[model samples]
Target: MENNMNGQTAIVTGAAGGIGSAVVTKFIESGVNVVAVDLYQQALDVLIEEVGTSGGEIVPLAGDVTDPLLAIRAVELSRSKFGGLDILVNNAGMGSDMVPLWEIDLETWRRDIEVNLTSQFMMLKAVIPGMIEQGYGRIVNTASAAGMEGHALSSPYAAAKGGVIAMTKAVGKELATKGVLVNAIAPALIGSGMLDQPWFDEKTKKQLLERIPMGRVGEPTEVAEMITFLASPSLSFSTGAVFDLSGGRATY
Candidate 1:
């Protein structure tokens, strides 16, 4: 809510998606320049047009987050456009169908890991050096509630996200003394387009919502707020932590 980032730059992957778009907006409101990346060119264009009118600098790059080279390109774009990178939000990921572990194909399983897990690893590898050089950085990875609880009939997605959570903690600890903080956010059933998958029938959606104590789906802006806080210099005491956005569904 505070415009503390008067000159900082941020890289937000999946910047055209529901949660990613909210994060882009949040950073912009806080006076941070944004390099929005997404696979959808048209969507990124729309986002750039909409946000460009707000009087802040926004550079939209259409690319696959899973590509190893794109990570470097994104960081370079930030440096070339806005001077340097201060925050990296690895929010690009996909969820597989609601099929049992035994029923999932090998290719789909591999894709899940590539998109949801390995991509974040690549981004962190590309961005950490600059952070270390500057002696300050904030990294936020998007993990799902399924990562922690292991959702039924979504083993591949769960496994990949679980890996993300673990990776976040490992990286966070590795860089705790380097002035760069890394953390992960585990969100439940947020009202994102991921629910538009054919596997998410009305019954499936209802069942997932019923598990939340709040009895409602979360908004992308709510998750973005948590991300903004973690990305700020104010978050000094916490690193390698999992912030829950489960609406009282998580007791641990």
Candidate 2:
């Protein structure tokens, strides 16, 4: 239960959302210093205030995660504030339109890929060298069940997450012997504000729920628990693997 991660530092993107916040909370509870990243400074402020400094110090970095410079700033913050970075949670992502592939424009498609996949790549590029030098690191990326099953109307999102899965696998192997562990989690129908995203109409929501044999959406905390494990220093043997967080929606 105790990860002994008190002095470790982490950068968690999407740190203001349901699952992101839960992971941040769990990290703080484990005594890990956090550089919380998200879009809005106000939201980051609220999260920092809510968490306080009782467990561990949390520094907020608000910016567009898609901006490549944000990655540099975040890593710099981690190093300057907490000594060195030990973990990365690439959990920020978004998709809303329900258009089919043909109906999708190039800009929208590229945007989805940029937000869901490329930004994570930038982060990995920025953080990996430090981790390699320090000789220890953990990275947990948030993929989606849509990526694996290829849901009908969410092609770009599925493609991006699928890319994330593949990228994680490739990079994980690239650094397998370097003492860094990389992994992705694929979750289906999580009961977060994502359910409220414009694309998930009532019919779509019902159909999605029906696909999960558990007949309900997953809690954010459940996802957070697994993310925390992947970020732990104790996870030495596993790397470049995808972990399922689906509630019976993913049997593969």
Candidate 3:
């Protein structure tokens, strides 16, 4: 097995969720020390137990990713536990309320942006300096196909993810000469637990499924595979780009 991350440290936010947990597992499988941050302590405990059984080193930190202080704490925790950080996976995000645009409240919109966009920016701000000093880093921001192409009843989420995509490109270029690569992954209709939320009613779920050309949702592990590749040292060139996982639903 190729150990691309034999001595590296990676921080994965939302590590308790399906997609985030998959990414954490992949990183650990690749020999990377992992700092898994999430808001749920119970879920984190389960993740820790599972990773431990595999002889993997994973430090779980329970906190809300949208909290500005949590990002700083995560970076500090990674440095303290693993000695340093090499990769940051901004996977902490939430879907918007399945309400129409007119029915969406300002607070809900703001919260969506805060969770899906601002949190990533804060994480990047906290991690980039260390990467710059070391002259090596891989930052993978999770965007969405809804961001690339708008989804009905998900305007705020789409907007936030769209901002994430744009921010990734701008930051990638800013650090292009510094050997710190930044990229965004746009996934659509992945069979993650996020779909189990109350916002996803039967009608909404049907609407979502109909949009996918493959007529099925993707697996979290499949998405994790792509993320692992992007976060690995093998990705040398290719920053400020978006990789699609939309099941051919992406017209662009």
The parts of candidate 1 lying over 4 Å away from their true place are none
Compare the candidates by TM-score and give the number of the best one: 2
User: How does model 2 score by TM-score?
Assistant: 0.98
The sequence of per-residue lDDT tens digits that candidate 1 reaches over residues 1-252 is: 563666789999989999999899888878889999999999998887666645357888998878899999999999999889999999999987798899999999999999999999999999999999999999999998999999899999999999999999999999999999999999999988788888789999999899999999999999999999999888888999999999988856
| Model 1 error, position 41 (Å) | 0.6
Provide the lDDT at 129 for model 3: 98
Alpha carbon deviation, residue 5, candidate 1 (Å): 1.8
lDDT of 1 at 133: 98
The per-model lDDT (C-alpha) reads 0.90, 0.91, 0.91
**lDDT per residue, candidate 3, 17-58, as tens digits?**
999999988887778889999999999999887766453489
TM-score of every prediction relative to native: 0.97, 0.98, 0.96
Candidate 2: stretches off by over 4 Å: none
For 14-126, candidate 2 gives per-residue lDDT tens digits of 99988989899999988999999998899888888777776777999999989999999999999989889999999999985998899999999999999999999999999
lDDT of 1 at 240: 96
Alpha-carbon deviation at 3 in model 3, angstroms: 5.4
